[model samples]
Target: MRRSKTILLSLSAAVFITGCSIKPEPLLPKDIKSSVKKDLQLLSNIVKPITKAITLEEAIDRAVNNNIRNRVQKMESALAYKQIDMVYYDMLPSLAANAGYSVRDNYAASASTSFTNGQPDQISGTPSYSVSQDKERTTTDVSFNWNILDFGLSYVRAKQQSDKYLMAKENEKKVTQNIIQEVRRTYYQTVSADALLKRIVPMKDEVKDALVQSRKVKLQRVSSPMEALSYQRELLEVLRSLQSLERNLMNAKLELSELMGLKPGTKFELSEKVRKNYDLPEIKMALEDMEKVALENRPEVLESRYKERISSKETTTAILKMLPGINLNAGINYNDSDYLLNNDWASYGASVSWNLINIFKGNTYNKIAKTQIELAKEQKLAVSMAVLSQVHLSIVNFKQAKKEYELSKEYLDVAEEIFNLTEVGNDLNMNSRLVFIKEKLNYILSTLRHSSSYANVQNSYGRIFASLGTYSDMKKEEVKAKKVEKKLVKKIMPAVEKKEMKSPTFKTYGIATSNLNVRAEASLDSEVKYVLEKNKKVEILKTISIKNDVWSKIEDGYVSSTFLEIQTTEVK
Candidate 1:
């Protein structure tokens, strides 16, 4: 029985030690690198080879959620919220506990004796100096302090913090606006690249066919050798153009993927097709009204306004520095010479303090503060001017892009008609091969130009909306406005749903280890389960149940799964 108890105790100890010794999993280099490389390659393939079938709104949503810079700004904004909360309670009283112990080798006690009228006066006993002695002291104190008043200085400081918080909020808005513009621009570029590729590939095939025909005709003595050579040169040129377009397409894909914060080399197929027609909204408002809107809605303008308020508060704080600071303090202290029950002392007193003589020495700081106020005013003006200038530029570009899109559409139609006529003439032997080729080239150029012009106009519209600080508002308004007009435009488009592949699942295991190198036999299974592949990327997600921690009583937020692709095998 004693032996069995000993064995049981040993086993229990071993289990406890193993359970407590468990460490987090270390990073696996080979696996991580391989996974990252695979993810990047997959991204590259998608963007470079796949057709895009994602909408602009979807792209923007992805960018906002995934873009690194945008995410950083979002985090900063969140941190600022906490800081705002902290500053809001700055006026509250603070309490602190302190304890200390000290040992001294030398201690002295002294008293002075005074003689009145040539006679020595003594009370209780004669005053005498004591020999050095060791002393030990220990003290514990609880203190509380509150700033009752500071001539509006605390108020000014709080206001400054509030303004800073507001500025941070506006900065977040600015980042969001910038992100929307970037996503829209990149989406347009991707579409343009796709359109150009479509045109160039067909043109290349046509040129190649023409070259082959020319070679056959020359060999049969139906055409001159020089003509055949010219056709071959044209084919080579067309091939070079195709190569350039392919390179451009690849670059556009890479840029779009980067903007969307996909792993480098990720593939994307644009879901939105290029549309040629855009109904330009009439600008009925005067420039002043536009400026007013910008001032009212622009995040940068709001930031600048907040900065001005911050500057005003800073100036007030600096001026307050010139005033003398006064503080009232009173505290009770207890002292005892012996550790036991004798020689105890207690005292309490109030004290006042003032620093009145530094005024002459620190006038320079006050002067600098005044100068800063002026500088801040100038900066505010500069920001306002820049905002107005940008708004003007955006308006001008919007008009220009619209006009170019219109012209390109008309030119494309004309070019298409001419090319058709030339093809028919060639069929009847009434047109030369060179004329036919030139007409074909003209059609290709027209199509490319029209596509590019349309993209440019769309991007310009996005910019204008961004500059007007109306992108988000416009997005909301568009949804509302389209509902009433849905019947009229119902035939213009059809809704398409995207299909996604099923994600893979993996099981997690918990292992116990007593030492770093040796595993223990005792292990407990955890009931927690987490989805690892939510985003289709290789990021790990760990979830713990509320019952596992001290804050188990409080409801925790839902843990989403994160997915990472490990490898891709080519299927035969």
Candidate 2:
């Protein structure tokens, strides 16, 4: 019987535990439906059984929509939005529902049998006995509270949350812009590298042909062994350069793919070539115009502005701390000696509270908030200066790069003409091998310079657009420059603008005149100045300062018009 009773007690205990335990509800199917659908779509896109080349824009779109980092930013923005909602809701009355049950058993003597005051005389003559009984009880309650008046704390908190949401939204935009820029930059770099590899392939073939011809001449006793060895060394050098270029090209492509947030080991083929065919924008306005654009469009500048606004709100909130807070609480409670609804009882009441003594503590936060506003102001000034400098530098680089590209094209044409004449002279046995090789080297150097100059122009444009936060607009403006006619008085140049000018007679000077010595001279307008310096035996003259110092001309003839500071020192 005792064993049976023990099993029965264990069963009762298990039931009681199970009844008191809370079970969490399963996630609703609709909760994750959107996420599941998105994942499936991404999987389908990536696993599609076709090999189609994706454009840079398409890649960037896919990355922004599906990339982990971007998705995280989006989620953070959403969370901030929810937080703002929560803060607003804090100002409203809250309602809550609660229910519970309990059971208990007590072993004690009944009070009815122990109390016999009138029968004391009979009780004294006979022994008194009391019967024991068991008692059981259970109860449950529900309650809620809401702040009635908090001295604008709720409103200030909501405003702060709203600012946070705005900041997060701006942060999301910043991340997206950064991702797009990275994708575009890496895509262009890969395309450029590929173009360079294509250019090097023919050069490598030419070196191989020259090596073979030199070896044949050596066997025929027409060329010395030393000459053949020189050809071989030249071929080896060409091959090494080719290999390095190829490796770099591959690395660039891989990097681009990675930036697009592609899976590891995925291959990407650029659909377009990195040709230097884009026309420069007609930027007639001064550097100040570009700086304005940067200030308005740059994400960092906008973010800083938002931060300053947030700090202002925070200062107001801190000052409002001097006021006392008042809260109201009201709730309904029920109690019962049994778990039956009929035996239960209910009660409700309201109360208010405040912290009047804490107003003296508000001064500390107010002072801190004032300090924060000053810090924000300083930060804004620093960012404005930095943005101005960046815009100025980018403009100067664009001008100088355009010039170098034009010069490189002219140099390439001259080198090609010299190489053609040298080839003819070599065939007629009038040109020595050394002379032919020198001409070949010049031709190769010119080609390299042309490629480098083209790359520089493209990079400068990229930087300019990047600073303006509009690099994505380049997709619509790619075009090649037109060829111009060459005349005695007006040289119409290819890849450069044509202008009419007087042709001066060429005269040799024994020594360059000191009048050509360009020094940093302030113009009649003190804001404008000119500077000159000699480098690598070449004299370079530059306008060091404009009315507003829009651009700086470097010794290399490259002009950097962006607002970036140029380090200058007194010439010894």
Candidate 2: residue 396 Cα off by (Å)? 1.9
TM-score to true structure, per model = 0.64, 0.63
Cand. 2 Cα-lDDT:
0.59
**Which parts of model 1 are misplaced by more than 4 Å?**
1-53, 85-94, 102-137, 145-154, 205-229, 261-271, 275-278, 284-286, 330-357, 361-366, 427-438, 477-572
- Where model 2 places Cα greater than 4 Å from the true spot, the runs are 1-72, 107-136, 149-152, 202-228, 260-278, 319-323, 338-346, 352-357, 422-449, 469-572
lDDT of 2 by residue, 1-572 (tens): 57767988999999999988969888789878977899766755663232677765676776677666888899999999999888887777767767665433334433333446666333354455454322543445565666555526788888877877887887887787777667666766676666555555655665576667667777887767786677667656756766675676668777766566666567657775533233444455467677888888777787778778778887777766655445555566655543344554455555545466557767888888888888888898898889788888988888898999888878876775555444322322212444655565566556556656765765676677677765445434333222122433311111111111111222111122222222233333333233332221222223233433332233433232332222222233
Clashes of each: 25, 12
In order, candidate lDDTs are 0.60, 0.59
**Best model number under lDDT:** 1
Clashes of 1: 25
What tens-digit string does per-residue lDDT give for candidate 1 at 534-559?
A: 32222212222232221111012222
